[model samples]
Target: MKKFKIGYRTIKTAVGACIALLIAEYFDLHYFSSAAILTILCIQPTKKKSLNAIYTRIVASLIGMLYAFLALELVGYNPIVLGIMLLVFIPTLVSFKFTDGFISSVVIIMHIYNEANFTVSLLLNELALMAIGFGTALAVNMYMGDLQKDLDQYLKNIEELYRSIFSEIVKYLRNGDTSWDGKEIIEAANLLNKAKSIAFKDVENHLTRKENQFYLYFDMREKQLEIIERVLPKITTLPVMVQQAELVADFMEELANNVHSGNTAKKFRSKLEEVKEEFATMPLPENHEKFLAMASLYQFIEEMDKYLVIKQTFRGIRR
Candidate 1:
């Protein structure tokens, strides 16, 4: 399969950092490199996003410096105290949202503080450096186009997740066993919801300028998710269908795994024909709800089928 890939975030980060360094370099910004570095580091490509990142960084930086001083005062150069500080601080950095930002600010503060060799100086230095770093990162990200791209990527993830669920359900309907990893299902659902929430906030924040396509696409997505929620429970009954549907899922899995035909379409077609035979002849739904739901299941399959066709078309175009 031809994979769609982009590193806009990394590229933006690198360029932003480069520009920041040059800016600092040209103007002799004492904290320029660190500021540029902060811009790169605080990037939300991997996390809560720009505002959260900025907030976390500032909070963490100040809090961390406070922690540093408390540690220093309490431990006071004792090997045991330093060790304890390192132990607590390391996990704290990893665990807390802005600990890394704060710790970094504190460390820089410590350097400047020791340069002046005073506690008050250290605090001032920390605050100054954090402001620079946070400000620089903030400025660069504002102009750069990573956030929209990030939202698109997030939407893509959600799309893949729902598609995967669709595929799993297909397997269940035909194979009679729905025993896939529950954790995976739950994780994908939870994460996509979070991503959706984040994307919604971002779109709202940039409503004045950002594209309306985001809104339209996500509106459809909400419908898709609603359909999925209704359909997901139908999958729970698959264990009873396993004896009849075993070959059904196997074929679907085989077709799904084959991103490229290599003339495997013949085999896939044959397998699909066989599935139609089994599914067509299988016991029909006993009630209106079951029948409507079953019809909807076909609609879900129809969507996947249509998607696979599109995937194939795109592949052909790429080739």
Candidate 2:
């Protein structure tokens, strides 16, 4: 069974709803309970999302009030008119991309319908309820818990996975060891996906910041992981191990040991150039199998070069 725990969002929702209801009741607003409902709907995980929710709710509520006035005052304060109003209002809101506010707007429509009149006092009461609820939710949601520590942890985890993957590659390159299960590839892919998701949420939480360094870092790693996956078959399926394999294995071991957030790709790129020059000076393969093995190793080196180039282009992580 999954463990049950109340998270920060749940606490915020509960507190915001309570504050909305108390404020509405203190002012003796009609249908004060609706304030709590609005609060519940408006409290979102990120500040940007909460702001968008409030904007949609407020706009849709105003539009719903206008529809309620026209349908009930001109036609009749009856169930049939209410149904017809919804039929038109729902489609209109959807077309305008205000679907998020559908429930909140319906509450406003119901209040006007129950009153059976479109009086100024009723309009002001409904507005007051919206103000109290949306305001409380905004105030409560403003204090989002810091996500920097979580993002940092994700970065560390990803680097560790990358290290493990490179170490495994080094082992296979040095010897024809097919014992490894290659679980690190799958694990790295999954971690990158999750890390990118959380990093994007962090970006959303910061309204002024248009870009997040962690998001960029994870995205770069994801691209590099794709290249790594593509080259895995080439490495493992080499027809025969050549002398150059040991050299490549040495480079892989170095990379694996030095997996970190810092930009050291340039240093490695120079070393890679030396390895390529060494390969060019080596004697041609005497057999077909040796030729194939050398070709695969050459391709692997090229792929590794591409990998380092990707990192070289990226600006180092901010301190």
Candidate 3:
């Protein structure tokens, strides 16, 4: 059944056109044959290129017919004159890579004239051929059902990846390690890379189906992802500086631990005060106290990560 459906459409169209042509022959209806040919060949569901093909075929057919009519009028109904006209026009059509049906229609129009006279019957034949061809293709496409489900899924995945990267960054920062010490940076980079790969493949494979306008967002995100990745290595330096500050904070924590354990409180309090003052006075990136508040966030995250680490560790926390 699946195989039948798969091959049925093309065979059905050919048979339909065959029957029309045979009927025209039996009834001595030449115009019906032309229209049957036109219909079967002109209509197809090629999506992006369908309208373009139809317009070009229509134009080419008209040119060929017009030239034939002009030749017939100027030179009269001579066989030699018709032969010479075909020689001149056929190459002109072939030179431009027009479809077989388009060029054949011209030849057919040149030769498909009635034995009786110029009549409405001839025009109807050509028109009917085109209608059948076009209608058959459209029917086949509709029967195949929807092919756009993949496009929707692709868009959804892209949006989800974008939001996931942002949310993960927030979670990593909450650890107070601005240096991006954990898995956050790597995970974001990997996911972003996957996102780009998916987008590129989707666009490349289905440019006809994809929207050109939506591509702007894809390009923008790609560039931003590259910049963020480049900045990541620099963030590593920030953790080193924060780790130094964390050492003092760890010492203060230890002192508090010692004092709680009944060690001499006076010396411990004195040292704790000194360490706290030094930590508070740590120079900003720009060496300005006012700007200490403006210190690099990456550095602060690392410093805080270490501070929290020791605090947690002293209080018997695993991480």
Candidate 4:
């Protein structure tokens, strides 16, 4: 049954359609199915999108009915008239920026064709169907709820990957442990990409545009991951400067534990800076290999600085 489970949106649409049918039947509308059809179409995942769908549907229905009425009154109902009506109506709706309603508008055209006469009673029936369909969708979506929990879960997943990646880096620096396959780095990047998409959808769900912190958080992680990749290879080539490497490993360990903490980022940056200064004071390398090692360590410092700066900047951003 788990494999056959349906989504909440599916359930909501079905329930809304049934409610719409009951309302139309109670009102004695001849084409009660029209209300149900509209209900199914109008149920959207987000309240904002649902509202927009309702608005466009109603406008398109009005355009459809108006065009149908004019065409029927002047030229009479026939296949030729219906063809001409669609040609003109589709373009007119496009010009008026009501294209979102065009598909739903076809149902209105069908109703006009079936009735074959444009009368006040028939017009009332169309309006009643619109009200019932749109109203049911509205009521169903009012409790569709927010995606804050889902966003939080994504954040947690991404942070776990971050922790794994940093710990791997720490292990390599401390003992030159080459057991890590770098799979976590790729996994983290992929997860961050997924999280960014969901976070943007969350942003769109709100009527008022707001800064999506989750999106920014993942964006920062992605930037840090890129720096990590570059740092990994450079650190591997450095001669074992046991004391310096231990300092780096300790800082990385602290960073992995507090991946989500903004305050810890500043402390890590300060410690890394001290390590950079200490590296500079060490006696000049006696050969090319030592010089290369010194250069690589400096490069690693610069990358680590950039990584910490990304998080710090993200935390300070207002939007």
| Steric clashes per prediction | 8, 0, 29, 0
Which residue pairs in candidate 4 collide? none
What ordering of candidates by TM-score runs from best to worst?
2, 4, 1, 3
lDDT of each: 0.56, 0.92, 0.48, 0.82
Winner on lDDT (1 vs 3)? 1
lDDT of 1 by residue, 1-319 (tens): 8777666577767876776667656755455567676667776543336767888777666665555567666457455654576677666767775565654555554554344333674456445556666666676566544456666676566556655765775556664455766454565556656666656656644625453444444444555455455545654553233233454456556654553312333445555556667767767877676666556545444544444343333212111
Per-residue lDDT for 97 in model 1?
A: 54
How many Å off is the CA of 163 in candidate 1? 17
- Write down the lDDT that model 3 would get: 0.48
Instruction: List the candidate 2 regions with Cα displacement exceeding 4 Å.
Output: none
Q: Count residue pairs with overlapping backbones in model 3.
A: 29
Estimate, for each residue in 20-71, the C-alpha lDDT of model 3 and write its tens digit. 5665566664455654565466434443344555566766776666766677
Query: What TM-score does candidate 3 get on C-alpha atoms?
Result: 0.42
Judging by lDDT, tell me the better candidate of 1 and 4: 4
Model 4 — TM-score against the truth? 0.91
Model 4 alpha-carbon miss at residue 28, Å: 1.0
